[model samples]
Target: MAQKLKKNTAIALGNFLSQFKAEGNTKNPDVLNNNLFYDDFTDLIALSQSHNGWFTPEQVYFAIRSWAEALTEANLNEWLSRYDFSNVQPKTVGLILAGNIPLVGFHDFLSVLISGHKVMVKLSSNDQKLLPFLAKYMISVQPELEESITFVEGKLENFDAVIATGSNNTARYFEYYFKDKPSIIRKNRNSVAVLDGNETKEDLIDLGEDIFRYFGLGCRNVSKLFVPKGYDFKLFFEAIYQYGDIIQYEKYANNYDYNKAVFLMSLFPLLDNEFLTLKEDTSYASPISSVFYEFYDDLENVKERLKNDEEMIQCVVSNNLIENSIPFGQTQQPKLWDYADNVDTLTFLNKI
Candidate 1:
């Protein structure tokens, strides 16, 4: 089974990579307008957008390859070594995926697959095509996985365990519906940045990726920032505005215009642009909200506030402040070693 999974993953990854040069080169303007998985051209655009700017076809090809490499048996074995799954066997696991970002629920899917369990995946309508396409490729490589994988469009029942991701509102529904089952029902989480006022313009530009990637739709996108008192907003805005082309999305432009108006009406100060909005706020979560910045007079005092809101926070983006934080641009591109909410995913799978 391990060998089959490895071979299949490799073949599927190769198939995806081959499509890039062939389908990605067609220059149809209409094809550039839709979301990923609707078509090959749109999928290319989505990949480029998620990367914070334009990505070369080769770069997109390599990124998909990297994801497949992580699914190999050797990699899976190394990841699972930290957890004791010897006696744990789950018959069925239900997965409710969030489609806010591309392939955001993939890790959970991989966890269920490599842990020797059957998966009943309920994909988000927004991202219905990619998972199934990838699954079909996998099955093409290793036909045995066909029996273990099932894609459903409606409610799932009789699963031994569940792993669901959604907004804070949907969490209540998940809690009530899956209360009797062993589950991990995730709520909303926002990432933040702590700037020490010593950062270079280059650092701020990279930090922009954490802020504006996918037009700030992903949970990993940094919505709020903590800067030293008297930090200059001018330099920050200048650095991030290089990726102004993202505003070309009509939906994103409408969001920016709407949010800008709301802030102005409320007498809130703002930094305007075709793509992003910068404002001042205390909260970390931004929903079509601008790149809000808050000044911290004392670093320790800010740390105390962050500790209080850890549940609402995902990761802290900084240079080298502490153990839990990552580098500025590394927010959207999470390493396999970085587990969600610091939960031991393999252990969670084993317990089921």
Candidate 2:
């Protein structure tokens, strides 16, 4: 398929995606093939939570909206312009996707197809529906692309290269299994926020979005905090109190009750406000409904610590305290260029 056709098809898919929102599904008659896909996609959004209890309509809508925003013509052109697709040799690329978040592995799917490669995907059982449905829509837009995409039910084979995402244990297996192939193997990583005493109440409130979105299941969710010594929690708690309604969700409430009980039984001191818990710990990965925090006496030391621990960290949200730190509440909203684990997916695709 021509590169222009692929890009145009993605833009049309984006238009198709834009109609399904948390507020309601709007069928735009102008969008291509909407008559065929619009109702089905809307029903999928409504039924997603049944497949995975965490896949609520609101969370699924947010993921779809993010993709719709990313697949615009300008964004696609700017992202693709940096690479030379000329003289590209088409190869089959295998993908083993992760299912922690809604559409978590779509970027890899998009990367393989956009880079002029055939993709044989082994979908995570937890996220089996959304991407394959989108793939069908893409094929509808450009029939030529139907041959370039395949969803495998069992083990993947006949691939020149592979990309896989999983937990740390699964990553070990992936590394051993695909060691000979040119690959990008992503393991566990967690995002953290660095805090100073001077941040406004609004800033802390916005940080709530970073913590609670997707029920804190995604690698990009802020799971830890680096706070200055002697900082008070009163203001921070008050700022984030607006998001306490999240605890009302059945799954989140169950997690909150269970995790809080476990922590209490373990005799770990925690600061709680009914919905979320804050514990002082050194670990970056936190349990659902909880956030681990560490105190630092100096800013310079925090920068050194983050730099040395960059591999275990996905994103560092800060108020410009560190160089290249992401702004507040933007960890989940990664730009096309903001590749996962700081490894450029396009660069990997362009080479393989």
TM-score against truth, every candidate: 0.84, 0.99
Tens-digit per-residue lDDT, 1-352, candidate 1: 4634643454444434333442444333342122343375346445654443323333344445446445555655566667654575647899999877656787787678767788899998666655676666556556788877888888897688999999899999999999999899899999999998788889899998888776687777899999999887778778887978767666677888898888889998776765777777887887663777799899888789889998998889998764468887878766565777777676788877
lDDT (0 to 1) per candidate: 0.72, 0.93
Q: Over the full model, what C-alpha lDDT does candidate 2 score relative to the true structure?
A: 0.93
Backbone clashes in model 1: 0
TM-score of 2: 0.99
Model 2 stretches astray by more than 4 angstroms: none
Cα lDDT for residue 306, candidate 2: 92
Kindly give the number of clashing pairs for every candidate. 0, 0
Instruction: Point out where model 1 deviates above 4 Å.
Output: 1-77
Worst 10 residues of 2 by lDDT: 18-27
